[model samples]
Target: MSMMKTILAAVAGAATALALAAAPAQAAPTAPHVRGTSTVPAYSYENAIRESVWVQTTLDGDLDGVPDKVAVDLVRPRETAAAHQRVPVVMEASPYYACCGRGNEGELKEYDANGTIAKEPLFYDNYFVPRGYAFVAVDLPGTNRSTGCEDVGGRNEVLGAKAVVDWLNGRARATYADGSAAVATRWTNGKVGMIGKSWDGSIANGVAATGVEGLETIVPIAGISSWYDYTRFNGVIRSPGYATFLSEYVSSRPEACTANLAELATGSGDDTGDLNAFWAERNYRPKASRVKASVFVVHGVNDTNVTTSQFAHWWSALRTPKKIWLAQQGHVDPFDFRRAAWVETLHRWFDFYLQGLRNGIDRAPQASVETAPGTWVDQRTWPAAGTRPVRVGLGNGDGVTGTLGGSSGNAKRTWTDNPDLFEAEATATPNTPVPGRVAFLSAPLRRDLRLSGIPTATLKVKVDRPTTELTARLVDYGTAARVNYQGPEEGITTLGTESCWGSSTAADDACYLDTAEDVVTDDHAVLTRGWQDAAHHVSLRFRTPLTPGRWYTIDVPLQATDQIVRTGHVLGLILQQSDNEYSTPSTMGATLSLDLAGSSLTLPVASGSLPPAGATAPQVKTAPAPATSSLRRPDLRQLP
Candidate 1:
């Protein structure tokens, strides 16, 4: 009887153990939560996973025998691995991470003792990682720890970035620092969105133009669409050896990239300022048709560095889902201009594109333009709806002041190229004669005139020099407060006080200095300017040197613009030679003659017509020079 009772107890104990083993293991913590249109922070940011990998590319940009390896630093929610959940990626592939730095405060990446990333430069990881997203910071080949030579915007740079997207989608290979395979297939959902400013943003533009898979969207702020446009404007070189200089500036080992630098200098075609196969390879506009990802473009109307033409040409070519924000500032990020709103909008954009959120962001207004200082208006399309080109002829008068619209005979005006004269001086005293430049003014507007889109200047001119540089400027003559884009602080002044954007840690903080628009009152502001070389007047691909005193007709397409000319303000066109700020100076004392009857300024007028030529002209005022400070310029080059 005792043995039988013991057997029953043993059987019961075995049955209880089997029942416990059969029960399911506790479920891992749930992924991030979604409230309305945004991904809420349901995971701990401080405890997020941080690691680095080297992605192999199919390029030997440094002339090495093997393919190059691009360094990728990443921060992701720990829940992704803990719960075995996959997340999308938000990436910024940049050359500025270890050199010029990034954002308004010039933050650089910081790494911990374990050779992994400890802190990223921007608020991306701090804000998005906790929301169940992975933030990847990739160093372009030849920059930082990446193994290759910087090729500017060549195949090396563009393909290197695309390889990261390929790796995220399990199409390319990546490895840890110790050479062990590092696979993202287990953690990634295969969706990627790229975002950055300046050169970093330019890479995003290039990568998206490749039509790479898994790239869902891109936010390119002041990105260059064409390398030719960045280095040259209408067949005129902006800076000689600029490509080589930039490559060396961002390279981790400049000595190893000597051949690459030489190739860039030669391929840039600065000597001829003509588009070639080299520049063609770097031009992304022609490849826009291949882009499958949506694009969110942010550009400063007053950004003289990258200029408005970069975004203008690229935006016009895109047929994919797209949106734009034309800011009033210079070369600056939207975060510094409109922090709270930018963050919220960017959050929605990422949530929609990356997380597959069915939020209505894709259905939102297609364009948001800063019509005036601190004023932004949403529109269904850019160019402000009813925009059409209106051709207004230039009437002959004194070499200084002429009528902008009216029947004009064969009167001619002449101005000599003065390399020493700056645009400020050339555009000043419009009603009075200015040496080295000729000006034509329209009667004060009866109502506010909104000029949208690009303006083209058709000029019949004669130049004595074989190759003379021509400059055309659309100027607004009035006294009003406008964004100080040309001032030392490029439209925003950084304050001492700081504001935090997300959760923080000892190594990485979300806090940054506050900024405000830097506004200044000026009598005249140069709205848009275009530069061209007479030698390449016919085509940007070739040059046709002019015969001495020979007549030629050229179309100078001014930079894209959207500006409102207030009533009582005069609209003026200044024709000159050698824009000292943007182009190489023409031969000193090269005389230029303009046939006024044959010349006209074609404007994309969105509202109001120009006053009759016989109407009264507004009195011109001479305002003091705009204020200047010692603030750093946003252009990669340092101020004098």
Candidate 2:
């Protein structure tokens, strides 16, 4: 079984016990323990209680400090023979909570004082002991059972992690459910690795940056590197999302939670727009530059919750040897099928980096899945440059196809910006299903058009309305054969970001990107209505590759409107008007110039198919078109 499955089961077992103990009167059960010399009093809890966990020092962690009561659970192994084996160590920090939120000083209490592990499902019996990895989940200083005050952006969390590493490497002993040595000091090899989703992922990155002795590898899933991108995207607040998240946790912590919900409810932690020292401290950019350990970066493309931009920031900034895996799904994709691949990939990485095992990780694929393709792409570097940047334009006309070089070819297409429909709120309308937005398409490839590059869309737009915004997306169309864009659609649903389920087959009614609601939170800070930067053109970019024999579509929708009804999926330069947050902007007085010639999306086209030897060019052939009619740029008005 994979380490992930084992860990999941272990955590589940612990959680189940906690769930059974929710009754008000019963004493929570004490975790089994192995007799060992303790620098501090043995941590005790009511044994008859249905669920309970406590922290007691097995060894003095800090010489200058008194033995601290550290929150922990001892999960024994299944056999004495297993106890002798050098088990791996998995260390993690919990999310920022009331007592645990950065800078708050409070003991790590049972989540909700329920004492049930189920409530904290991330850590259960299904997760660690069975995998032969000792799982140590710490509440950063000043939270739950641990001493010290919370320092949200402080070094205490990383320092505490290092201290635990030292203690675990020594003569510490842990007892499993069956009273076996799940972790004995003898089993430690002075090696440790960290794994966490979201906040835990951030902690892992922070600890790795410390270059703590014995630390080996890290798998950060959907973790943030730049606080700027998380709380604000492109300098705009994703609003209630980031603000709500902050408020929820701050309320949990009594010290920092000092503010009334009303106070906390006021979104925007700070009002400054510039990058200052305070924000810098909270940002992980500096730490990313210092990471030396091998890292496995996993994130979802359509994740508006944390925003994929943060991942992109870290992936671009990290100085360490790293491999990034895009799940083409949502934030929780790592917990699904990706988990199996992650376990295999991570084991090889750790073995190669930490254990000196030649598991061929050095030769493993660098860029993994691109949503629709559903397969891993092995490359020496990311954004593998080379695929030529292609540009095409948008034109008007009927349902019938219009030839590219027709005598009646028009240079520009115009749409009205109705003032009645356009407003600051227009941007939100497109987040859901809008009638349509402007789209641009390239001529069908004469030769197999191989692309793997960054895409950019720019529109020379003039709006009569002062407040409005635009959203653009690049989509791949299956022309010659079957293709699936629903990979993203279904992936997000699995991650619990949306309620929509998509069909695997290409059915117009069943398969479509979810535009029914604006998943992009205000905190995400994408372009917003009333805040359109006239000097700076609005565009959307993400690292995604398109396959051959497929027609890719780019959707640029104007959002926030109050007039006109729009519906259905329409192909071509289509424009629909609506009041949805994700819909197209309403027309007040607007003249838009979609400068297709100037805007280009570059893709890395591989030379010889058999893995690129360094950086060589792919063989190219300008084959004739397949007796096909010329491709035409669709109009904007006739869209869904």
* The best candidate in terms of TM-score: 1
Tens-digit lDDT track of model 2 for 1-640:
6999999999999898888776467654322221121111121111111222333343332222554334443332334223354545665665443334321012232332434321222322223344344445666554554554334433544555556665566634333334444333555566677777676677677777766667778887877665544553333333433433443443224453333333323323434233445455557666666676778888765454555556665677777678877654544535443444554566466556644555577776676744232445556665453434434333322212211211223334335433333222222222222222433322323333333433333344433333233344433222211111123443433233322111111111111122211122121111112222231222311112223222223333222111100111111222322322322232224433333322332222432111111111111112232221332322221100
Lowest lDDT sum, 10 consecutive residues, model 1, at 631-640
Q: Candidate 1 regions off by >4 Å?
A: 1-31, 586-588, 615-618, 624-640
**lDDT value for candidate 2?**
0.41
- Give per-candidate clash totals: 0, 100
lDDT per residue for candidate 1 within 529-609, as digits (tens), equals 998888888888998989988899989989999999899899989888876567664345689999988889999999898
Superposed by TM-score, candidate 1 places the C-alpha of residue 289 at a distance from the truth, in angstroms, of 0.3
Q: Each model's TM-score, in the order given?
A: 0.93, 0.55
Off by over 4 Å in 2: 1-87, 96-132, 140-187, 247-251, 259-276, 354-356, 370-380, 384-436, 445-453, 459-470, 477-640
